[model samples]
Target chain A: MLLVLAVGPSGPSSRSEGVLVRDNNRSHNVRVTDQVQSSKVPVTVLTGFLGSGKTTLLNRILNEEHGMRIAVIENEFGEIGIDDALVIDAQEEIFEMNNGCICCTVRGDLIRILGNLMSRRDRFDRIVIETTGLADPAPVAQTFFVDERVRDELDLDAIVTLVDARHIVWHLDDERPEEVENEAIEQLAFADRIVLNKTDLVSADELEHVVQRIRSINALAEILPATYADVDLVEILDVGAFDLGRVLETDPMFLEDLDHQHDQSVTSVGLEIAGEVDEGRLNRWMSWLLANQGVDIFRMKGILAMEGVSDRVVFQGVHMLLDVETDRPWGAGEERINRLVFIGRNLDREALREQFSSCLVEAV
Target chain B: MSGLHVARIACRAEPLAELGDRIASVAWASDGSALAAGSLSGQVVISDPTDGAVIELAAHELGALTVAWSPDRRLASGGQDGIVRIVDRTGEALAEHKGSGWCESLAWAPGGGGCLGAAVGAQVILWHDGGQLETHDAPSTVASVAWSVDGRRLGAAAYGGILWFERGRAAPVSAFEWKGSLLALSVSPSGKLVAVGTQEGSVRVHRLWTGDDLEMSGYTGRITELAWNSSGDVLSVGDADSVTSWTFRGRGPAGSRPDVLGGHGGRVLSLACAPSGRGAERIITGCADGRLRLYSGTDRSAPLAEIDVGAAVASLAWSPTGDSVAFGDAEGRLWLAEVAP
Candidate 1:
């Protein structure tokens, strides 16, 4: 496997403890691209259910000195509240850093903030992103891969999950646990390291049972027990982990590898394209998708090398709504490609991929 | 139906004289033959429809903000000085009614002889021939007022919501509350539907009798005005970005969203739909970007004709005979353009 090396800033000065495993060494044979130059900037995605100690953990992180210049991106569910007076240097809404980390509001505010962060590359050492309790990680993850500037300037690190151990069993047994579990499990599923916070409140057997549950969902992930999410900073950072690489390595059993499938409630499918598509065809396809598949598909995004266009066209749809915009051109020596990832339940992946591929402009 | 015939009328944009710096409000008569243009200088210009010749009438003190004409062709003009002046065809002030607050919106009852309604502060006042002004307390600051066809009820759209009142009732006949502040309201010709445009970019349509509401959402900006066609089947709503039309199909359920009619550039301040039997009656819209557009509800892909008015248009009205259209702008200039079917 050829590893594409990304040329940019030099790697961080600190040494990484983990051994770099070659692509062929893994059973999945995933091509691990060394294209991104790591700055050792740990972008910790603090995620949990609503009112699940995410902000509390954030407040603690801000108070303690970890030596690294941490830029926190706080994504509040409603209107943002005033932060404490101690963090006076923080930007009210979205701010960047001179050390390499960038912070911003969540969801819609992500794109603009990331775009701004990429413009000033030398500013941040690491980024810590916090998401609203209800946000799906797919869109945020896709952002790092979809934009060339983002992929070059920043490297996606570990996803840290904060679990309420006291309410875990009860939360899992509720009628709509699928709602809470979907976000929780997805965050955990993609995490390189899991911090089962608030463990002091749960019984010893219950804590062990929860750990087993987490392992059942993701066997590859390292589970770390913590009373208040207080773990050594070195464990969370410099993990040298990439889930996308793991996903590609799984090959034949890509989606079927996990023992627990995405909640019988929600599922996702990746649609690949071999050729450029017409603008009109895309519009018709989107209208048809909105009319027929809108109710079923909660989120959908497509990055296509559109016909007659030099730059890739990125389309994002929330429920029945769709917005399309042009992104940066394909990088030097990079292939002009078309790839769409759809996350929803009961979706006919084969049929959708076929329909999406048929929309491609036919060669004369 | 017959290949969608679209006709264009061209008018040379000429700056109006005598409208110097004191201009206020402008409107057109029902027949579209003449215009009732008022100014802050207490001057009114009654211009000919075919050629821009004026019949100037010096009517009041202080600037006029709104103008309306009764079905019988009596011109009613309201000013910021809290005075309502009723003028005849020759531009002579016939009746003058004095009020306490600024009179912003003026409308005549459809079939009633000479009855008129004006929104002054938080009260909606109905003025009759005997010089009596019937005042009704509005839920909030009254923004605009419109009278139903029968003249039996007057609908007032306030900063809060909708207030419907009958002639003799001390209390409101009925009221409807919406999520955002109300900007304008329009009642259907048959008195069946009342449409209210809100600042939150939504148009809420309520059946006059049942109090049922159907909301149509699409605009990301504020809705400025609303108008109903003569037949009352179609409705045209004006928002900050565009003007949309909706077909009220006999009112079924609550909270129904209507089909959107999209295409317009600036804030659409006013809209007027032609009466029935005019052969695909078009919707005329006045925009803040100073463009008067005519749109065919059948094919909303493009505008039939766009007239550059050179200033933000404040109001638009269609002729009773459907042969012409009248438009007013922020500069107190009124234009009457001949329409060919």
Candidate 2:
């Protein structure tokens, strides 16, 4: 295989060592160009279900001697008040835009709170918002883009979703009413980092089952197993999962689809192909796909080899908004390859692959 | 072609005072003698617009969010500290009211009444002469508070709707129900209608007593700036870059087209209409691009004059006499400009 992608339960066993093999070898192949503007403040959104140890992780992030001055925004007043950490209680208010798109909603309270937080920008180096257990993460993520001031001044560093290894499966399988969303699945689908906390409570077999279940829905997120939410802070913070300049650092093996029994559930479809894509054809296909199934697509990210183009095209999207930028030129004699991943509900892998394949350049 | 052209309205602006941080709000006294400005660093300063002499008032601890000058020269300020302080023109603190959440909005009753409405979290407290008269609760945190031209009714805007209350009453006499969050509110001078900028980047107006609602949509960003002309015939709304003023003279702005004003390179942060008799149809807007422009109601294509303040304009207000405009920028600098035909 020209591309090395880890799929199914065969991923590196070193994932439990609290160190990323990719990070150690990052200097070899991955050229991470830090193109994010330095002036913008980075915000990490922490979300999980009940009993997921979200509060424990938040406390660790706050009280740990990380040498970073961080402000915390929470749903209710908690006892996490520590030294110099500005804690603000915000009421989660979801506001739907008047433009009539149902998916184009944002958190109204965050817009107000973040605008006020900007005035005291000199006091803190970063910010973290902890959402309620049952809260949907869409509105929170959308607020950073909907509000002008918040979009201009704040950068969404990453969405760190904590999973209770023993209880997450039950929560993910809970029967939801018609038109009701399973927030647990949504959280996993949208996460940039998955902290599988409380691993000591589940057996090895049970933990493997849970990890497999999670992979059936989301494949791009790097999962770290921990007990009592004791994962290293460096893995979650400053991840740059949403930064246009540096993204798609997932282990390529995760891009291979493992055919699990999925009945209209949230699933991830990853495509790895060897060839350059025609820019015009790729754009047409992407626009058509987004327009047709954007509401069902939670997140999409990829790096493409454009035909006759020296630089690689890095793109990512949340719902209907797609962001694309030109990266550094492909390394000399580097294998020309294109990789794409989609995490969403009711995704048809075959149709998506066919549509994408039609955009590839023909072999001469 | 009717009023002053973009080049004809000449004006000179001078720095009045400088605070420690970003200026949040600025208000001019009714007599145009003194200007009060509040900064996000909790500093409040009262400056003599003529000689630029400034008096430093007490700080608000957290950050001052709003400052309003009453007709009797009493300056009322509120801040993130949840304290509403009423100070006389000499910087004497007459009363201090504390609540549980940030006090972001403050309004004094017009027509010489001393009743001041302060929004401290979900409750709107009507304070009079060192005492709390009544506290009205809303469905959510109050975004703005405005007084009717006659001072008979008070309008408090929250997430669900606008609550209208009479003085000394614990319950709201009436309310205008809406679906989304209201960011800013402005009641027409005729006291017959209320206009609100919503979190959804749209402007909604409700006719008092009739409950007839009008919505103007398609703004580029959240509508945080709304102002009404003296005659109550025009309602100007600010967005990310442009200002659209709707005519409310006829059966309302229902079917009438609005006059769109552009040329500001950045977001419009503050807007104020001139007082009734003197500069009646004129409106001044301060933008994030650090420019202030004067626009006549008759012509919306271009501004009457553009003055660069060199920083994001946080707040601006017109003097009661309508001859002077006071504005504060993000750099904590307060400026007073004299406008002439």
TM-score for each of the candidates: 0.46, 0.82
Cα error, residue B328 of model 1, in Å, equals 2.9
Q: DockQ of each model against the real complex?
A: 0.01, 0.17
| Model 1 lDDT per residue over B1-341, tens place | 01132356444355333443323455667666677766544566677766667777655543556777787788888764567788888877788877655576888877745778888756788887667778987655576888776787788886556888776678888777653457678888778878786644466777777887766654544465677777887777665466656666554223344434455676676777777776446777777677777776577657777777777666666766766776666565656665554
Assess chain B of each prediction and give its TM-score. Answer: 0.85, 0.94
Model 1 residue runs over 4 Å out of place are: A1-364, B1-7, B12-18, B21-26, B39-43, B50-53, B59-62, B178-180, B250-263, B330-332
**Candidate 2 residues B1-341, lDDT tens each?**
12334344434444788787788999888888898999987899999878778999989875788999988999999987789999899999888888867798999998766899889888888987658567777778898999877888888898888988897677898888777788898989888878898876677888776877778776756788999888887888887778888877756466566677768888898999888886688889989888888887677788877877778877999888887788888888887776653
Worst 10 residues of 1 chain B by lDDT: B1-10
- Return the lDDT, model 1, position B340: 59
- Report each candidate's C-alpha RMSD, comma-separated, in the order given: 18.3, 10.2
At residue A310, what lDDT does model 1 achieve?
Answer: 75
Evaluate model 2 with DockQ and give the value.
0.17
Candidate 2 per-residue C-alpha lDDT over A1-364 given as tens digits, one digit per residue, 9 for 90 to 100: 0111111111111222111112322111112223446678899999997788988888898889878888899877632335767787777777776343545677877887788878652557889999977888888887775565787789899999999999999999999997899999999999989999999999999999999999888888889999999999999999999886675777454557478444579988888888888766776666667767888899888888888878777877677655566677889989878888889987887787888888888832
